[model samples]
Target: MDRPSSPAAPAAQNPVQLYGSFHLGEFELALPIDALQEVVTFPDAIARMPLAPAHLLGMFTLRGLLIPIVHLGSFLGLPNGTDHSEARIAVIASGDMRLGVLFDRTGEILRVSTGQIVPLRHGSESLGLIESAFHLGQRILQVLSADVLSRLPGLPHVLNPDLAQQASQRRMAQGSRHQAISFQVGGRPMALPMEAIHEIVRFPVLEHSVLADSRCRGWLQLRGRPVPVVDFASFLGLESCSTEAADGSDSEDLRRVMVLRRDDSYLGLLVDEVDSIVAYLGAQLLPMPAIRGQAGLFAGCISRCDTGAHDLILVSAPALLAEPYMAELAKGHHDLYLVADDELRDVETTRQRARETWVTFHLDRLMGLRIEQLCEVIDYDPTLVRPPGAPSHVRGVLNLRQTLITVIDLRSLYSMKEAEDLAASKILIVEHGGYKYGLVVDAVQNIVNIERAEKLRVPAMVANQLDTELRQDLREIVDLPDQTTIMLLDSVPLMQRLTGNGGGSTVVAALPERVVGQA
Candidate 1:
């Protein structure tokens, strides 16, 4: 398997953070809210700073206050775009410095939770006055610190030389988490870049009755409105809690609701509680090993925090949103923030991003599998059953259109659990060695375009969880944050684990042997 070339970056500072990731032409930006103030309509607040530096685009007056507006685009070497339907004057403030950063348009507001952020790399060369960044979907957002942000990127220098050099070194570093929030899955924590979370919510009722289907359901009420709830855990191959954490810690409090944007919808993820939106400037978080012959989706892991128990999961939710079915639904639900890629060609860009990345999912609950290992995605056809006593993972057989397919309960095979937090599920059909089997998955997440030089960060115990034969195929790990390591999973070995010699022993053996008996 190939490795990702891009290594993890460091955590962002001040207000601008990762989950704050948002689109701007071909570029994306995610910073802290503290880095920004209110955004007013462009023309309405076009007040220039009186005799301010040229780096300063000018001042804009808003609500009677004279605020200086800077051209963030021009600073970033992009074409000046002032013609926007709803132009906005982004008022940004960091410490003693304050500037109204100008934007072509006010993109969506990202609510990065504790787990989505990673730190920036230390000793980076591309620093150029920008410190860290957050990745959202297919885009990356560069973050600017208070002093570092005095000027925008790609523009001529104006700040003091000494300060600039420090910022640059801080960037392009060999070490740093890059994003602010990250999480752990299967024991490995990936950075989630904070700008992505909208609001963090905690609800005691999140733990729902364990339903049989890949789907898990719970109710979400917001501002007096009742919205349809979907299971997010199952979507990401995570196990849902039957009840709250053992400590009972505020699981029932429903303290915070993390609202995130996925294409056309705002996702509200329920968290146990909110942790610090801390900066992660430790080591570069690395991607999981490449195993399934596809570009892997997981970016990298974030080590345990000061609390040491609940780490964050930094990830690209839109990648999971792209599966054909959910993509259609997101188109409507996330209507307000949708881009006009009405031309399906834009999707090609996403495919291009896939150069060699792959992602993991479960066919049934508990099974960890990758979509690349599968041939195509299909629906479960109960009417297609054929024989008895096959693998329990094998959900019998199904006839789709004109193809004879065998249904495999990958979820059951991989041991993936359902998240009662958010939405739907998907099924993938994989083929190899002349045998074609359809595997059920909760949802198709993002396709990772893993770079060759990626780093691996995970807990030591989890690294021990990697199948012995599987460890050799992993990318590589320099320094594990909090001493955590993530060993990427491959399909062939997983297949053996699901149905092979000497593998059907543990509880996981239930699906394969059961299929043999029930078929």
Candidate 2:
């Protein structure tokens, strides 16, 4: 939809301003880049507020901040036919007012000049919402001011003094609370403290072991070690609801195995579907109701109000491990597998040897960088200052903790398509030759430990197609047991190549004098 445009001539002298544009109903809108926070995928759950305005869709927690979401089309009286499932939330902040506006989809980051923007007349039909308009080929781009939206009548005071104080106090109270991984077993809700879990993995093919019995399902290989898998519902004296195949294997698609850890020993608890991670204060849990045959296993019962739907039985890991039956199983496993002290030593030695920690991230495919090479990972900052005469790979200079770090887009360097939406992108801070640079990646996955033996050299066929620099950077690949392959990034050679010291031509040039001097 085109707004009434007062066409203005583009001037070379005008400063370029960045705007994060998005689609709302039939109208295209843009906000000053600095006023916008990161865009986020639509949250699964939004806590509905009682007696709130109709336009207020509800609120959700984003990185500890309670942001109230509003339906932009509903507030502006536009016909928004966009599906809620595919919508994205654009978080914007002005002074103390922070809000998330639901939009149909995100548009490109527009670099418009000041001379091209035609200021809207005050008290127009948009009611100060439309601050300016600019031409984009055959269409017009209406710029919305976050300050005006924040001050609009009938909007919720999300960061009001009273609410902020309450939020602060709530955060303080939550800081002392414990988090638990919630799951379902035999149609009943259960949870184990986060500290008790080593990792949660999808159900894998089980190999028959001596430990298999009424409670023990079978043994599953985890990192070259056999971890005894226990049917959680059977262990808790509850009949399993999962159906079995003709081959006597579990047929449920949602089955997950939670690997419980105690020092060097591991046990897997098979459950149906892993749910959300929840935090609860001690006082929120009611005392465990006495149940025959399952005594001392539950720490407390979390009410349905705290968790959704059915009350959750919080399992005490120490008590579960200390049970007579469970103790016998552990002892039997140790006796059968590791009877000798030398065998135990060998197992520990094998686990510790050549274990390299790598931070996995997504690009065109799964990729990794040595954790030691990275200083830290942080969210992508949109307020980067684009330096003049810089290479396309050099995104901009970001002021991080008083240091001007040059942010580089790895996609540009690799000659891949640039990411359209950077809502979920992360910047990996790396230091090389005393200079810190931020590498923008699609998304940062969890850190994983890869053994040297697990690393496979890149096939010669694959290496020959790539230019020498990329080929050297991705010389090895790690194939995990889960069928996921990760290309290991040789940071030393990559840094050297980027900094123009390697044998091959560099993808990145030397940092601009201004950026180098500031750093």
Candidate 3:
């Protein structure tokens, strides 16, 4: 595989998460990006199986592999979306079963945050395959667990022992088990690892702050000290649970603040209500794919109760307060009360700051790329050129001042449909190892400055669960105060996809004198 000329960046502090979104009529659904292998047109030949369920569409040949086809609409009792020409097959692999699900059309690849996912309500028990659901604007998208589908009663076989063993080992590793404090926000259950929590305090004297971080909801007085408080709902990028009623008046009063302490510094998180402290097994916590344009607030998903209870999203306290701006705000609050007395004089007060910038843009939705690998953003019409034998991702080529640049469709690279209605779009001129290319995107948003401390390394297990294409190229995610997540795209694997250096079809610009040879 071809590597970028730029020095490799340090490991990401957060996991880069994404999921594939598709449609069944007007209903939208999502599957873990790792669970899906590819999206392809319906096979030309499909053989029916004897004694198979109605949901079983049949079997087909794909790249020399036998894949069973499933009618997802029939299984879910929704309108079948496969009658149209735009219908496509979503290839899924779970343990031993490799199946294809029929969908009306494939949508954008979502950069999903773990916190954005919520468990299905009580009445949704009828939707067997849906593990959880998430809100996308006014619409809610059901999250389908392909593994569960593979194990359905009517399925022909069982999971491979080797694959099942590997999955079991991953969930039960040492330190995976931990006690957590569970609470509710916006009527949804959430938890935090008890280790990061200092104490739970109710009805602490509160005062509004005029000069704290924007994300800070207010300040709380505790132990003769001031702690900056942030609304837990807003901090997690959700609508305020305490919203105005139809009469345009606020409903509930602020309930309690969870005081979290990291060393001498302290921060308070205002929540809707506090529940209970429970010891949770790591095996019970599942990695959740996040929604695009949001930050990860929850570490993972937890379903404690089995009696029609919803899944609880586990909050990562350290990462929440790890933002440099939040840290600095806490320091300022701490220093205001720290006197030069013999008891307090020994404490260190020196502070330093580290920040990183990114070139932000919109693909199918909000996305970002590090400035290090980006050359420039330009406006160009790619319909001018079409090359012979180019891969699907390669739209064509562009000549900028006589330098040949390969223009690739970001949507296609991300396994999304082409944006035909988008008459105009921006091209991101990016470079890797002196090889330059133009990435076509929906639009160029802006430049953003972020604190380095806020970035967290995505857990190894989470990365392992993702498909190779995404797991390798997408390694980091940053959540903004507004509750949007920006993915940091790695250029190395991206260039390899275009150059065919990683055992795939390569798209090379035809130049008078080839400036860079194909890898």
lDDT of each: 0.44, 0.72, 0.63
Which of 1 and 2 is ahead in lDDT?
2
Q: State how far residue 176 of model 2 sits from its true place (Å).
A: 8.8
Q: Which portions of model 3 miss their true places by more than 4 Å?
A: 1-353, 457-468, 500-519
For residues 388-444, what per-residue lDDT tens digits would candidate 3 score against the true structure? 666676777776644567777777766776787556688887765555678888887
Worst 10 residues of 1 by lDDT: 1-10
Residue-wise C-alpha lDDT for candidate 1, range 1-519, written one tens digit per residue: 011122222112112232233335555565566565444445533444455555566654332334556655544546666575544455565653446565543333444424333344322223334455444444444555545665444322334456545654765474643334332223333444555554444443442322213443443533222222344444555664334453677523423344554533544443333333334545534445643522334444554443243444556544544544334433433343334433333553444344333444443312223334644444444455745545444556665433455566544444445334223555565544344456565665443445334444434675577545334223243322344222344556444444443345332344444333221
Candidates, ranked, lDDT? 2, 3, 1
The TM-score leader among the candidates is: 2
Q: Write the per-residue lDDT of candidate 2 for residues 1-519, one digit (tens) a residue.
A: 011121122122235666766778767888876677556667889988888776677888764568888776654556645358768788888997788888876654455657557676541223467788776544567898798777765666745566577766876775556566678888788988765665666677787887688878877765444578889988776876364532466543667787765544567888876664455666667897777877888999876563234677899888887788776666566556643544644675566556677779997789999765776577888999888878888899987655678888888877788899998899998877767788899998866778999899999998888655568689999898899999998778877767766666666555566674345
Error of 1 at 491 (Å): 27
| lDDT leader | 2
- On the 0 to 100 scale, the lDDT of residue 99 in model 3 is 78
lDDT of 3: 0.63
Better of 1 and 2 by TM-score: 2
Clashes of 1: 167
18 in model 2: Cα distance from truth in Å? 40
